[model samples]
Target: MSYFWTGEGGVPGDFAYGKIHLFAVAALIVVTVLMCIVGKRLSAKNKRNVILVAAVISLGFEIFWRGVWIGRGVPVLETWPLYPCNLAGVLVPLIVFTNNKTLKEIFYVFAFIGGIITFVYPDGIFVNSVLNFSILKSILQHTAIIFIPVFEYFTGQFKPQFKKLWLAIIGLFIHLFNSEYLPRYFGMEGDYIFLRSGLPFVIPGVPQVLILGPIAIIVMFVFYAALDRKGSKAALRRKKQ
Candidate 1:
């Protein structure tokens, strides 16, 4: 029980990519699949409501996460919410409440891809126990992150277009700028969006972002293109019917 709230040192059984990790990933996959299937039937109002609910939940978990870190004696400056997943608190709500197509397109692809990538890699919270605060909050926050844009996509709230891939590029640039500036300005240490130390397997000397960032942008473009194609076909089919 003590380890559940412990945040100072490494806890016991802090294994990543192990049984609990895989189980969590599997459960996320199941939930995502179910949401996709069922979300199609939701009304626009319902979808927007879900987005708002997700935003609230994401905000709550985000606060809880920061409180945990603050309680651990980490400096308030170092605890700045600059991480990508942290956007879930604000962006998810704006996606529904505003008419900002740019925000919607930028975040839709980001949330979907980023959420899945983190689950596959378990982010940085690698506790073996599901009961641990780190693992529990990580799962909950990412779940809200995954749910918001996914619900938006399935319910026709956001139809991703290849042309708007530029929006995602812009978002990436913002992350890159912060990845460099935030750590320096606040004396905090982190790779941000894997731009600093690189991916899970950090290279000996290279900051892999220069290489991986463009590749990831290309990957996001491809995904957006494929989704656009599917959305087009479905729309055409409905028109014909």
Candidate 2:
């Protein structure tokens, strides 16, 4: 049992890869539906704002980190062959219960617990220790970012602050800095950092540490700015009640 639990066969990626038929994602779908419906019933615009921010951030992180960096060869199919977990697990619940501060707190609490369980437990559930840190970091990081804006949206606590350029720039810097120590310490490949190969113009070869680092920050800022703009609009709409 331990062998089946800890060995290669025990991990989620090993089992779930390409096997589009699974129950977990379905469970996420069900949770999404319930949360959205219930959340709407108890709704406040502020709560909706929280969820909206969460949804956008969730999508941004997934797209930039998961889809672009790792799944390089795969085409960005917007709709089908769907990977729905992030939307379901993170966004839907966030939007639904953003008004309920307790619920939001619970979600983050459990999210942190889930992160640890998924990574450290090694009990045949999931793998990818390399990517896991970033994923988990995003979860924690975005929890803080998404919460204030979202809470404000529903509560009419403040006006929507639209600083796309700064938001994007900060996001880019944060991600670059986040990646710096992890890859080196873990001895993992820095394939996601851009143009060690593939897209040459984006990140050139030089003092890789210095060169790629700033470029990565710039690229991330561009990507995040777009996402932040969308979120700000959504929050404003929710704020107007």
Candidate 3:
């Protein structure tokens, strides 16, 4: 049987979407639900500690993964933590540790949306074997991404605000600009956030970056609005008690 630490794996020709993937997806969903339930049960201090520790572990794992890639001669441009998902590794820690409302909002909406999509359609990371470290890391990181925001919401740590959507939009634009323009200025071929070729799906005539950037913002807005409404209803119910 292959072990996660063996480091003896090859990139499969295509993502299988097979048993391992399904198991990981199912496990993530279960764990996220449990976190939401347990988060509500925890004392405020314990909940904060859980959030803080999870954020630190997520950020640390991301950095460690990048370091491993760099050690394996991966280019700085490709491994940079600038992609929306990678950025979440950094932003999540900041949100938890500093309690920065803007960062929290950006992470709660954008990260959750991105996390869900990436989890559902994990392309490269969905290996045929469960014991592969890359696949395992991918599953864990995306699980954390999906879990954190929801846990925060369930614990009343994050209250979605429509105005905070602007913060997320600005963050997206900054990443887009860096991914698109800074690479040219530096004479590097970088697709930092998949803005250049878009995600796996792209519209025919429109620039991939243009199409994805706006769509991402719009999707986040919709998610934020829905969650905000739900939270408001829950708040009202609580007040009635």
Candidate 4:
């Protein structure tokens, strides 16, 4: 009796009850709300609000896209439980928790750029599960990514110059290594949509992944650097005040 749920009249491998996925979703909603509250309570001058706003935007984008894809007949949540959406929920909140403007800005830029890039180049894109699994997986995956850099940033180990770029790259690679980026590898036997559903990523190809990965890293650096410059100017203004 595997825990996977099979929805009624849905695709064969889709889960109907989705108990585990539901629990994860509930937890995320609770935590995200709590983070919002905490961020609001912090002094306005502290820029906690900035982090909160960024988190909301980041998380909101994932939710929006998930809905869009599902509406188009791709039950992404049901099929790919460990999707990129999970990363958003988890990592976005860290900015609020840490109240670090620099790190927050870095993540915001990366998310903005990454989202655009993925949307524009959704090569392996396909609908997986529509059961909130994508949300949970993204939340978890991103949480892992944010945790390391957040720890390093606050603990004085992270350098401002390349920290954000490094963190984003590391996060993406970790997703790849842990199979978060390749959810089709683990879903139930018949649920690997990319294999059968004309998905963009299942084909035998090293060109896109290899090419995109480096391009993403470079873009991350460029974005991080620009954000860093802006942050430096802001810091100087505060110091002058």
Q: Write candidate 4's Cα lDDT for 1-241 as tens digits.
A: 1112222222334342255444544664566456545554556454334444555665565566567557758766543334343444445555556656565544544544444333334333223344344433344544433433443343333445533456666655654543333554545343221223443443455545555566667777666566477665665588799
Give the TM-scores of the predictions, in the order they appear: 0.81, 0.34, 0.83, 0.40
Worst 10 residues of 1 by lDDT: 5-14
User: For residues 1-241, what per-residue lDDT tens digits would candidate 3 score against the true structure?
Assistant: 3545444665455565777787888888888888888889999998888888888888888888878777778887677565667767667766778888877765567777778888777756665454577777777777777788888889988887764667777767766665567667778775767755546668788778677767787787677667777664665588799
- Name the candidate, 1 or 3, with the larger TM-score value: 3
State the C-alpha lDDT per candidate. Answer: 0.70, 0.40, 0.74, 0.47
28, model 2: CA deviation in Å?
Answer: 2.4
Best-first order by lDDT:
3, 1, 4, 2
lDDT of 2 by residue, 1-241 (tens): 3333223332335332222212333433454455545554554664555456655665555445545434545434322112112223443345344445433322322232233333322222224322344334333433433333333433443232333344434433433443444455655555433335444344444655466556545644443334357765675688899
- Whose lDDT is greatest here? 3
- The clash count for each model shown is 0, 8, 0, 25
Candidate 2 TM-score, true structure as reference: 0.34
Between candidates 2 and 3, the lDDT winner: 3
What overall lDDT, based on C-alpha atoms, would model 3 receive against the true structure?
Answer: 0.74
Clashes of 4: 25
lDDT of 1 by residue, 47-106 (tens): 667666666667767777888889889877765657776554446665656747888776
